[model samples]
Target chain A: MSMIKTDKLIYEYAKLDDEGNVIGTNRAIDAVDLEVEPGQFVAILGHNGSGKSTLAKQLNAILTPTEGTVWVAGRNTKEPENIWDVRQSAGMVFQNPDNQIIGTVVEEDVGFGPENLGVPTDEIWTRVEESLKKVGMIEYRHHSPNKLSGGQKQRVAIAGVIAMRPQCIVLDEPTAMLDPNGRKEVLRTVEELRKKEKVTVILITHYMEEVVGADRVIVMDKGSIVMEGSPKRIFSRVEELKKYRLDVPQATLLAYELQKKGVKLPDGILSTEELVEALCQLN
Target chain B: MSIKLENINYVYSEGTAYRKQALKDVSIEIPHGQFVGIIGHTGSGKSTLIQHLNGLIKATDGVYYFNGENVYADGYNMKSLRNQVGLVFQYPEHQLFEIDVLSDVCFGPKNQGLSKEECEKRAREALEAVGFPGKFYSQSPFDLSGGQKRRVAIAGVLAMRPKVLVLDEPTAGLDPAGRDEILDQIAKLHKESGMTVILVSHSMEDIAKYVDRIIVMNQGSKLFDGTPKEVFSHYKELENVGLAAPQVTYIMHALKERGFRVDTSVTTIDEAVEEIAKVL
Candidate 1:
């Protein structure tokens, strides 16, 4: 059931000298292994320079693994011949919407991917329309991408990938540039995508709130898979996650603090209501 | 530092084949010393609308009024308006191109035709205001961490000494600490400077927890304008418009759906905890 898999994933950026010579290689992702099952929402957490994004890129073959292997939909990303196939099966969304969006209009931008994929004219429009509707952007289909909000443009960017109908989607800090409302929209759309399209989602983010609803949570530190579990399990270790420079959800953190201060309670509290119900049961 | 948008409409590439009507008949008033949060689903015209208040974009129809007079009036001093209404753009780090942190932060004040001595003082103060240490002034912004580079960008805007400060998605892309650091600094700046503050954000949690008032937009129209509670109460409407308030509210809503008598009025964790204490 694993749709995307990684083995000993390693990536290095050239540490150049003053004269532009490669003095050494700074290891971005180091000896990382990951697997994502079909129809699962996976979140990766790491601090800056921790190589989370590097791994997201590797899944789509945007950057080949320096010393590892990645398979998307059972197609090896490192295989030169399978580059296009791997990419078509695993779409990528990045940090900034302004940079990724290309079309002048929303629908046209969504259609660009299918059109480039050599889909027939009639079918390209069909895919574009459905993708736009999926993201709840059909109303602004004729609007300029430039005129769209950061969140809307990003949805269009997602629509562009959905138009390709990829089996798996890798989003690198997709909500990093959105406002609160926009982030909600994008998250809802991603959740809907999993249910409606059943695409495997690999979401790399640092926001603890965003990960609460995810199916599985993977924590990366110094370019390695440091922690892997469901959100409840990952969030249960409050001090441990905080040591890695990650924040647990506020309610979870509060529950942990209260536990430390002599309250007999459970380990992980995912939402406010849970914490409220637990504390309310005081004997 | 009040900003009044009077029937503002922004059209990109006016009279061209690729023209876009970004903002349409949008009229809203933000008063002095008010903490307002602007929220919208993508393409809802919040970005376009905020840009007009600072004269970043000329309104195609209607006008933007700062204080009392129209900003886009004939021969209006746009530069002065800019100096008074500092706008920190989203992805602000992309705009930092100076060689050193000091020079970059000084860019805004220097453009205001201030003396080098005055500009330097403001830059130093602004950097401090944004919580950047003294050591960062000499270092290149590129050498700093992503969070620090973002701080430098905000400092650059702060150096303008604007009475009305506008931030576009200031906490986007930052981790929880980075987000809290930036949002707290903004709150402090508003208190210390007594400036009118407009925060544009996507996190309903952040908006609900911080700003006094909330403005929601959808497809270039203002869906509703009121307190966060008032706006969040329209959960169905917001969901229909591709928006939601906070996760806590959603959870409470879900609890209500399941026959739990938990108060759905709470928009945050602390409030939710207090309410659930009463219910359970």
Candidate 2:
């Protein structure tokens, strides 16, 4: 069975008037049927207000579907009792580290999630240690979260989520506010966590470079899934992506531009290494 | 009017055991009507330096001059200095709180004690400058989309009519199209008004495309300051400071290493395409 399954998910919310009267509804997620097997790393790319984040919120029961259903680890999120089960099975990390981190210290923050789940005190400490190690943040376990850099803080946030022992993790642009080095550090940490823990990852981001290595790429636009394929297949269609107001990696764009100039080049050049190898094949 | 700093230093928690020096012996000059990009790793004093430009933070040491007047001098009019230098912090959308877009944009000028009619007129013009629709002027800022909200926040600053505009990572979380639109608007504003523009960003590609000059900060000090070509040429130095040149520059360098005679200085995609086409 798939780790995450959504059947024709449609999310709509009422737009309230000044006195709290429902004026109209806005459809944020429209008929998106998605599936992810265990241990899969899926990247979701979309422009702002495209409902990618709304879909992520559904996975962890942050927002139940206005229509249709969402299942996490075989449990339906719409059912009230299964809310805790679904959330524990699928943890979430949001964009800003400052807003998400609540604990005074790094280890304390990681312990909050598992602690709320009513795990034994001794087991919570063990899980915290293991999660911190998985993210390579064990060295700073005692430091205050505020003192840590943006990258380190984000890693701590990830550890906090994984400490709950979730099977799937949904990150909503966790690295959007980070610098380049911070972004690299967070991405590397997530990759390492996926390998060590074998947790499913759904990363929603605007950065095209980060999506190039994903197991699959899902492009969303206007609350609908517009394209879904492997990174190679999706990035190959430069024109389609541009029409959606999305961009490819620098190497991919450069290769595309070179190809347009009548120089023979392969499509979907995702990285500098691949581009270099392709260029060396000519002349 | 130009902004000049000499040996500026800022210390956090001075006189305490945990005192940290956020900026150290930093000095630079931004002439009037210049488009400059500032880049560095986080905590490299980029934010702290920009905060000083508008007199938001007093330097612990060294001197700062705006239009030949010392900003820290006794009896100096800091309010006027602030009115001349406008700053839009990172994630500027968080700063918006007005009931509507036009009122939000009018907040800055209104606070400056401008007449209500003047504030509204400036707000309308600023909204137009940012390409925000006139219909949205009456809508709540919270109801707008992310890109629209960001534009409204920027319009808040533009309404002040500052001579020098400093944007701190104006496109931090915007999508590719939103990023392009915002940057394009800023560039147009700079060209049309000839106002000083200082943009702080992490994306080297953005720096290469728009700014004429680049400033690199490292370890709380001014590391490099020059034209985009001059600054990016030291790719090694940039990497040492936890930064990279534009990806095209690296690509061109790799091609050159493989005996291809492409111009390694090419920073943008179009420039690299042309340079590689020449060799091919």
Candidate 3:
């Protein structure tokens, strides 16, 4: 069964006049459809104004869609009674680690989510340990979050969501702020979580390289799913992605250019090794 | 022109209930005009170490010397050191409050007590330095895109005309293109401005492409200090410290695991291609 399903979702920001008067509305999302199977790792990609973030917000019910419905684990998010349920069902990790962190210490911060759900003290600690270990942050559990690097902080945040034991987790540009090392740390942690915990993963990011590892890639532009395919399939179409103002993986772009210039390399070369292997095959 | 930290230790809220040891006997030196990247798992004292560089946080047990002069020594005047070593923090947009881009960029220079004309000139120059158009001076800083807001924030620091510029996660909220643009601008600024630049980032590819040196932090201790190639060459060590090399490096290493003999230390795609071309 699909873990997440969205149908014809629409959202609009309210346009206002200078005097707090009501003006028209500006559409952010048009008709959109999306689905994610259980244990799938999905990546959402787009430019800054492309409504990708808006769609993510909808999944968590941070913003209710203007039209259509979203179902998380067969529960409709649009239903008023299930807002908290939806939030718990689909946890979100935002781009900025500083803003999302609430507690002073790493383990305490991870415990916050489960604590809010009224989980008992013993269970919270257990969840905290398991989650921290999952992200490989157990060693720093007693340390304060402020002293952590951006990537470490992000891992702690992800552990916090995992502690909730949610069925799905949605990250909105989670690694956007981290350095090269931090970005790798957080992405590796996320990938590991999907493998070990069997939790559904939704990662919103602009880095094409990151999407290469995802099970599926969803493209958003003007609040719609413009492209949906495996990373290889999506990257294979270099021209279509470029028209959406999105950059493919660097190697993919280079390979595409080489192919255009009449190299016999195969399409959708997402990594340097793949490109090299393909070129080695030529002649 | 290098900045050195000798046995630096810092504890937040020294006497309060919230007292926390952020750094512990840390010692490292950033050579002049060198592009150094600082990486660590969270709570590894990376932020605290960088703050001490410009005297934003005075070390409790060590010394900070800018060009071998004690910046925290008696009568040395930390205010001047701050001007010489400017910091652009993560989400630097929080520092922006002015009505327009020009006034905001001028804040640092104006606070330095430069003449009004000098402040204006520096603001314009700094804006251009970050690649913002001259016409953007009149636009409200809040009116620009997230990437533009970030540039304006960096420009604010640049207006100070510091010899050393430090950024803490400068590309946090930017899109991929914006990420590329900002990193490229920092590289260009380093080359064109010849300023000492220290970047704190989480993307290995970013540091691999721009930084001249890499500094690894874990548990609030300086673990590795060397060039990108040298630092990333210890990918296993980095992973043990809760880090990984760039994707290209990872792929290269994976190929090596599968019995291929290509070098894995190549940092950039262009270089990776060149290395692979020679072997393949």
Off by over 4 Å in 2: none
Residues B1-280, candidate 3: write the lDDT tens digits: 6898899888989999888888887888877888889988767788888888788778888888899898877899788889999898878998799989999998888899999999999999888888998877898887687888999999999999999999998886677777888888889989987889999877777888899899988877788889999999999988887777876777677656665677888777777666555554
lDDT per residue as tens, model 2, A1-283: 8999999999998899999999999999999999999999999999999999999999999999999989999999999999999999999999999999999989999999999999999999999999999888999999989888889899999999999999999999998988888888899988987897788999999999999889999999999999999999999999999889899999999999989889899888899889988999996
**What is the DockQ of the complex in model 2?**
0.82
Please name the candidate that would achieve the greatest DockQ relative to the true structure: 2
Q: Candidate 2: lDDT over CA atoms?
A: 0.93
The predicted structure with the larger DockQ, 2 or 3, is 2
- Residue B57 error for model 1, in Å? 3.4
Record all residue pairs in model 2 with backbone atoms less than 3 Å apart, i.e. clashing.
Answer: none
Q: Highest lDDT: give the candidate number.
A: 2
| Chain B TM-score of every predicted model | 0.95, 0.98, 0.96
Runs of candidate 3 with Cα error greater than 4 angstroms are A1-3, A16-19, A37-39, A67-79, A82-85, A97-167, A177-199, A238-245, A248-263, A271-283, B6-31, B251-264
Docking class of 2: high
List the candidates' TM-scores in order: 0.82, 0.98, 0.83
Determine which window of 10 residues in candidate 2 chain B has minimal summed lDDT.
B239-248
**lDDT-better candidate, 1 vs 2:** 2
Q: Individual DockQ of the candidates?
A: 0.28, 0.82, 0.27
